[model samples]
Target: MAAGNDTRITEPTAAAGRRGVLLGAASLLAGAALPFRRARAQDAKVNMRISWWGSDDRHQRTLKMIKLWESRNPGATMAAQYGGLIGYQDKLSTEFAGRNAPDVMQIADNRESLIASGRLMLLDPYIASGQLNLADANKSVLETVKVGGKLYSIPWGLAGGCFFFDTKVFADTGVELPGLGWNWDDFAAAARKISKAAPKGMYGSADIWAPAGTRAFYPFEFFLRGRGKTAFTEAGKLNFGANELTEWLSFWDGLRREGAVPPAEVTALENGYETSPIIAGRSAMYPINSSIASSLQGLSKNKLVVGTIPSGLGSKALPATQYGAFINTSMQVYVNAATKFPKQSIEFVNMITNDPEFAKIQLMSRGVSLSSKMAALVTPDIAPIEQSMVQMVQYVQEHATPLYVPWPKAGSQIQDLMQRTHQQVAFGQASVAQAVTRFIDEAGQIME
Candidate 1:
């Protein structure tokens, strides 16, 4: 979609200059503001550098979207730097430290840190000016990305946790595919049954909750939240106690001992979506981020279907509409607060997020549209997998609790500690009790 008619590269207004002076370069710089002082004074073209981490599919589509934006607005040029998620944060952090960060970026794990350090440009002004249309945004979803009462980022799409299963594998093993109401106990039992029935080399599931791998804390966080607690609070403290952590570790250990999941050797080799055991046919089900359903479907030969994660069973009281999973931003887009052309950057993000045609091209590659208007506009054109993601998200929104806060600033460090602690237990380097105790101690130190 085209942005506003104000496409000209005009001089900063006298008031804008005064506001910039009031904001102070150092303050802006701390927020990772664009260091446009390095640019030659005579340069007129409004060029912006945008960065994100993603697969080739996402890279190509984002470039195409950028091209579309440029075509609609003359005199604006957007250059992109894209790569995988690993090291993306370090790269962005170094750039920000050097005052050479991109004008726009997709911030994930580093979000809380960036916001806490004043590194992200507050989108409040643009939202107030109606430059970035958030009226269609889910208020609760929008609120999750806010830091200290100001919106720092805008989510790309909506997604929740989903168990993406291979129907063919379950059929072959004579195991029934799990339904929506299945509990953790049922999940483990089905896994064992399927593992016994399958070919000798294949297991029923991957150690998706494997601590040494990607988003290792997701399942643990899910478990905690399912039990009516959270891993961390809005105050950024570790919310669950040591005893709870022990139970989480012990449960995974049980799954491992029962041969319900792939062996450590197989899980240890996991790199990402491409190297996932599901793609390699080493397992029947994979816990996906719910947004990547289309990518998983593209990679697997079996008929892939999306289902809910295990519920609380009858052990704990649940809300009348409760489901175990929660909706979260798959990723978020934000503009540099210090960009010379904040209006242009915000407009670009607005089009990418709220424009109907852009949504169709994206096709929930990120996740389902969080905007009601965009979701409705693109509904007819999305792929079946994308449709399933939207449907599953709708189900969760109506039936599940939403994560109340963005991961804390220390989230990545906490996740690392959790992964290593679990890996120690998984590899027999430490007892579950030892691992849990160590994690609690280390985590307290990190959060402190």
Candidate 2:
């Protein structure tokens, strides 16, 4: 009943894990109470608690990896806790507050505060002492997780933002399938054409401000970078001005008015691929990170093709400018600072990240591995959808500018503000100028 404790001490079978995850999701939505257990240090034993939020596939593979780890290392025991992504932050935050956080947990894109707040174990010691291996990891990729000269986490999967188009829909609309050379103008025109041709109850595209689709701020950030503007500087400062954001919002507005994208009301219904117009055959395209490629494909029977994020004028004009897709560390593993078994935790992290055997089990379910060796290990068995994702990431690395810097401490708050104002502007609750002005003022206050 604890944050990390299950009905049984060992890992749950796949079926049991699925049931637990469903129950966890239900409890989260209903706001029902869950019993929290305090950490208990068993004397002379390496019993450690680990937790993560993932799909059933990830959960099952991770459980097998845990069992393998225990088998390989005698006198060790790992109690596992896993669930879906909804309400994960609140649950983890509660554990941290109660000083009962897991030894190892999965960290997603928004862990700047967790690192800055000193709630994560500084991983440098483990790396230096060779308890955690990173000799084959990409150094540049490794640098992305550093905070204040200390590494608090390691990437679990590497992916990039991409445009996923249903080939059949594009063909049906008589629009060219998007590829590397596609630009914003082409995108807009294609969206309009697709919307006109789509079956009833469908639109050209989903609103880019979709909260449950790609990260709400991604399209805005991509636009900024395409224009050679910084959304946020390396120092965690706001990089673009109100005028630029206004232009970005105005672009979306044009799409809405021209019927090139769904209206605010339609977009409001679902932010993810499951119910998205694109997946449901109402739209021609969906924009999301490469990691969601298979999810999109699984939900639809259409032949989906991976496409580049639509480019801006600067990328075409300069040819060498920092504008293109976002090649980013999409998922990461973080150790709880309060863990009693740091060595055991580091070992688990190392095995999952670099072990060739473990890599085979994981395949590309977590996106392409950042380590070249692990990627090679998993490449042969990779599914077609996953292969597309890997190729997409590789393409972004070769073509685009570096991804945006980690958000400042107030990054998540700023993102939420942008999502709210974007909706207001799209729905006519506020004008473009008014929304931009309000956002700049409030965001400036938060950054200050």
Ten contiguous residues minimizing lDDT sum, candidate 2: 33-42
> Candidate 1: worst 10 consecutive residues by lDDT?
314-323
TM-scores of the candidates are: 0.86, 0.84
lDDT of each residue in 1-448, candidate 2, tens digit only: 6745753544566668889999999889776433322223226688888888766667787888888888988999999988866678778888887888889998653588778778899999888888988998877667655776578888887766677888888887788886666678778878888888877666777778766666567767777777676578878889988777877788888899888888888878774456777776667777776666655677778888777777775333223245545665567888988788887888888887898888988776667887889998888887777877787777666666645466788887888888898898889999999999999899989888
- Give residue 194's error in model 1 in angstroms: 1.3
**C-alpha lDDT of residue 62 in model 2:** 80
Instruction: Give each model's clash number.
Output: 2, 2
Evaluate model 1: give its TM-score: 0.86
C-alpha lDDT score of every prediction, in listed order: 0.77, 0.76
- Model 1 stretches with alpha carbons more than 4 Å out: 1-39, 210-214, 315-322
Residue 167 miss distance in model 1 (angstroms): 1.5
Candidate 2: which stretches are off by over 4 Å? 1-42, 313-321, 402-404
